[model samples]
Target: MTDTGREEVVREEVARAEEELRAAAALLTAGIPRVAVTRAYFAVFHMARAVLYAAGYEPRTHEGVLHLLSLHFVKPGKLAVAHGRVLARLHKYRGEADYGDSFVIDEPAAAEDLVAARDLCERLRALLPDESNRRE
Candidate 1:
């Protein structure tokens, strides 16, 4: 795809991810632990991409989320390392919330992650003005 096409795709995906995040927050707020954790996870995923786009890298494929973060955001020394922790936790939580049959989500865990993701979003927005998600 051309540069412009790729940018559009990134924008669309970012929006989709943001919607999922909002849904996740709502689920959490409503005492829906399972669904809330799921939403918190995707919120981080999209948050990663929002940073990617602001850095002039648009992720279009499924691999693009980690791929772009690994590229630009990862090379900033300690910040990259910190993001790695976020990536690991989010990725595992994504799989756990989706596939693990006996997975039991707790309110504390859900609340903590939701707060972390919301804070992360604020930090990302500070860094990337292109982010369009609601400023939770």
Candidate 2:
């Protein structure tokens, strides 16, 4: 993709991250912890994608995104290992929340995931250029 195209993708992913965060919060407020956990994970996932796209990467799968994130950012110490751990943890929790027949995400767990997701998104957002600098 051209630089403009990549920028557009990055912007879209950032928007998605923001939207997912809102949805997660709303879901949690509505007493839907399971779906909230999934949305929380997605928030961080989209933020990761945005950061990767800003750096010219386009991971094809969720695992690919995690691997690339560790290889490019965490291993290089551009991001803290804790950030990577949070993403991985959320990924695992999201799987359980979405796919595990008997798995349950309580409100507290979903709330913690939301907090972690917000932190990860903030950290990832820091790696990108300021919003004002990007073309609309």
Per-candidate TM-scores read 0.73, 0.94
Q: In order, how many clashes per candidate?
A: 0, 0
Model 1's TM-score against the true structure: 0.73
Off by over 4 Å in 2: 131-136
| Model 2, global lDDT | 0.90
Clashing pairs in 2: none
Model 2, residue 121: distance off in Å is 0.3
The prediction achieving the highest lDDT against the true structure is 2
Worst 10 residues of 2 by lDDT: 127-136
On the 0 to 100 scale, the lDDT of residue 27 in model 2 is 99
lDDT by residue (tens digit), candidate 1, 1-136: 5656655655664676678778977888788888787777677777677667656675875467766676666666424466556666767777887888887788888888777766665555455544344343
User: What C-alpha lDDT values do all the predictions have?
Assistant: 0.68, 0.90
Q: Give the distance in Å from residue 44's predicted Cα in candidate 1 to where it truly belongs.
A: 1.9
For model 2, how does the per-residue alpha-carbon lDDT over 35-132 read when each residue is reduced to its tens digit?
Answer: 99899999999989999988999999999999999999999999999999999999998888778998787899789889989999988988987761
